[model samples]
Target: MAENMTGDIISDHRERMLNLKKYYPFFRLIDTSFSNFKDGKYEILDMGYIVMAVLRFFIEENNFKEKDVTYPEYLDFLRLILKRDFGLDLNEQDSKEIADYIFDKIKNDGRPFEFSYFDPVDRKKRVSRMKIIESSIRDNTVWYSISPDAIEFYLDTKEIKDESRISVSQLLLEKMINSQNFRGGVEVVERINEEVNRLKLKKNEVLTILSGDVFAGIEAYEEFVKTGMKWFDDEEKLFKKNRDLIAKSIEKLNASGSTGEGYYRTMNEIYSLETQLKQAMNRHSELLKDCTEMQKMTDDAVRRAKLGRLRSHMDFTSALSDMIKRDNADILVTMLSPLLKPNIRKTFDLISIDDALMVKPPRYEEKELISNERPEDIEFEDEIEEKRIKDNYVFLMKNLIVCLKKSDIITLGQFADAMKRAYGEQILRNADFFSFFVNLCQKDEYQLGGDAGEDTFLDAYLGEGFKDTESFTFAIRKGLGGQVILSDNCMMADVELVRKEAHGE
Candidate 1:
């Protein structure tokens, strides 16, 4: 079966090569040791070479460093390279076996030949067997084996060797378990448990609220009831009728004041009546709200549950892709950058060219100079109060200074230009003014403009002063509040710069 599969792969490659030759008549095929035919079919003499080529292409394309490579790394590398470079899609099992075969050859060839130095031992002769073992120990080629004699000989010879032999199965298992691609299965299980518990707790709370077994505070409710009864008793007709009865009760209470029994009886009656009135008034309000809230919560929970499985699957796949591409910075840059159009090859410098598309021109609101309230013939000596405060300009200048102090940008010149473009001319006078502030804020020791000292023109126009700089610094700090602050800074700086530098200034 394996031989037949190998023949099929060779035949496929030959057909592909022929198709390529039809399209490009000048195409040439390179000859290698493995490119040989036997029994009317190509023999796969150098499967290891083919596997290595695929692995190398993946590593280079993905920017995978040499140190990050592992057993499963070679497997994924083979899968991607086969699909991407040769347009060959391999299933999981085929990819794994291919990777295993490559690694096995590398391991075998890396060590010296085991049978080269020692003669075969005769088991019947104990002395000869012992001699053979000793001889094998002396030959380093025997280090690859996991046999008891090999292990004992290695331990006796070397002080730093591991006591246990590392098997291929153990290494492969460890690689799979530790790999970022497969490890997230544990996290998915944990999140599922958490979500389940949360749903259960919410359900219990809703059921409790739906039931009308709630108790009010005993003392406060009783006092409130007594006050309501007292209000009723104060009415003229009611009070007149109850006056004699009330006096009799007061007299009875006074006579039994020392006993304390009658006083407790009177207080209990008042509290009971008050509780009845309050309960009837607020009967359904609490229960209705609770049921409505519970229904809303149930709807939300159902929606989340419906999406949970799909979301989890998406999360796992995204995480796997991220893990595979973690070390491949160049590939990520290529994937993310919009500059990679069709067959165009993007260099490092050209990666950020798309940012130019983000630039937008400024807009201004025009107000009429004359109001409708004044007649066309009416003329008055109205003086316009020009309240010109330099605070905004000063603030921007100070900001530029702060950017310089942090060494985030070498010069404020470029930052000033970005600010002018983002905000418009009403705020920043022009690039010259922006450059002046940057130069004022920048250290004298640094050069004007080389790779080492690139200028930030936007920072210069905003302000080169310490306070403004500090504000900008604080705005860029990480977290929730920092985002708002940064946004405000950008808007204010952009707008003011545009307002001031509206002309070519």
Candidate 2:
């Protein structure tokens, strides 16, 4: 029975695991189960919460494109948040010290956080490293942003606004784009590009190892090739397929011949995506060639190492063992004394030895009063707003389906008119209506799989109104329609909706 259950489970997730491993180091800082060097130093009240607070701050600052996020601002934020969130009233000096310590961990002390793990897919060791946040030199001072890996890691936890109709992609980046989940498609490709970067870094690691230690380098090179070369053929084919798809999309846009503002805006975004995709493709190709050459170079090194290629320095341990074997006990101490000598340094103690005698005895200590009563369940504004929007989604979908039932194909203009007639003109002005436009553009295509079936989040969000209608496949188009003037404040590019069976597709 256990084997039957296990048989249904999909276990090989090396690609997903590789993506997830990027965040392991960041969380490793706060995990009590794992030992970190700074664990003692960062032992603050709710250390994990504070760490997340700092990470969220970085993400928000980057979102706002703030160029002036320096240490002073960070210190100020730390001071205020500690007081507000945890009621830890710390002095200025102490606050600065804590802020500086946290900043170091967030930046990983200007070095990449590194880790190695065995990938189950290929049964090979894979090296993964990422900095949670990175800094840039701007005007001789540093400014920071959340690193790409961290951004991807954060995004991984978020569900797509419209729960993917099928799967986001059962396969690759191109399929994702084709599914009309545009941003997800772009980000998915970015992750693949990151995989290429990791492989390149792995190759360089092998070369660096080889330069110092021949045997270790040879082993590392073999492992690197084994992991990297796995994707060599698939990635090459994927790059071409994606680029061709992009070209086809571009062609479709040009073929539309619409000179609307929305048309040009979408064209510009596609152009930018095209440029980035080309760069990633080029980098991936070059990395493949470099890995192949490195493999050959490493093979040569292994051959030389087998022939007893010696490093520049003599092996100290081997020499010591030989001496001991020869029974040269008298000279052993003489030879080892200098190496084993205690590390020499100079330092002065801040506290004098005599001060210990003058230390006062402990008196009665008063602790802060603790409240035993259960705290009220907090309701966040974001959560409230999300709830409001989701409710809006249910109502809007209900009305839209009603309109679609009147006619097999419904255009945005038609739907808006029906909404204004059924509800009120004010409904057209609602932000929920505007948000629907945004989601539609992201995933302009949708269809009901069957009666009483909820294939996508859209179907579920449609409420009981959806189950009342028969099965249908509907797609919205931005290119074919003119501007949809729903309200004075809210205007959207005219979107045309067509049913799947109408075109016999």
Candidate 1: C-alpha lDDT: 0.35
Task: Kindly list the per-residue Cα lDDT of model 2 for residues 1-505, writing each as its tens digit.
Answer: 8886554432445565666776686577665321343465434456566766776676556543334377777888889887898677888877787777667766665557767777655568876666777666555466776655565555564432212201122133554445444455566756555655666667778888998898788788767655566646755665676778888887887898989997877777677667767767787777778877887888887787777645576778888798789977676687789999986987864334324632548988789788999878776444576577768886776677667667868888888898888888888877678877677566666755355445555456654445555676777767865888876545788777777676775
State every prediction's TM-score relative to the real structure.
0.14, 0.32
lDDT of 2 at 305: 77
Q: Can you give the lDDT of residue 496 in candidate 2?
A: 76
Q: Over 4 Å off in model 1, which ranges? A: 1-66, 109-505
The CA lDDT of each predicted structure is: 0.35, 0.66
For residues 26-103, what per-residue lDDT tens digits would candidate 1 score against the true structure?
111113232333341323334534533633343233221213334455567667665676565667876565556544
For model 2 the local lDDT of residue 245 reads 80
> In model 1, what lDDT does residue 137 have?
20
Best prediction by TM-score: 2
Considering summed lDDT, which 10 consecutive residues are worst modelled in model 1? 126-135
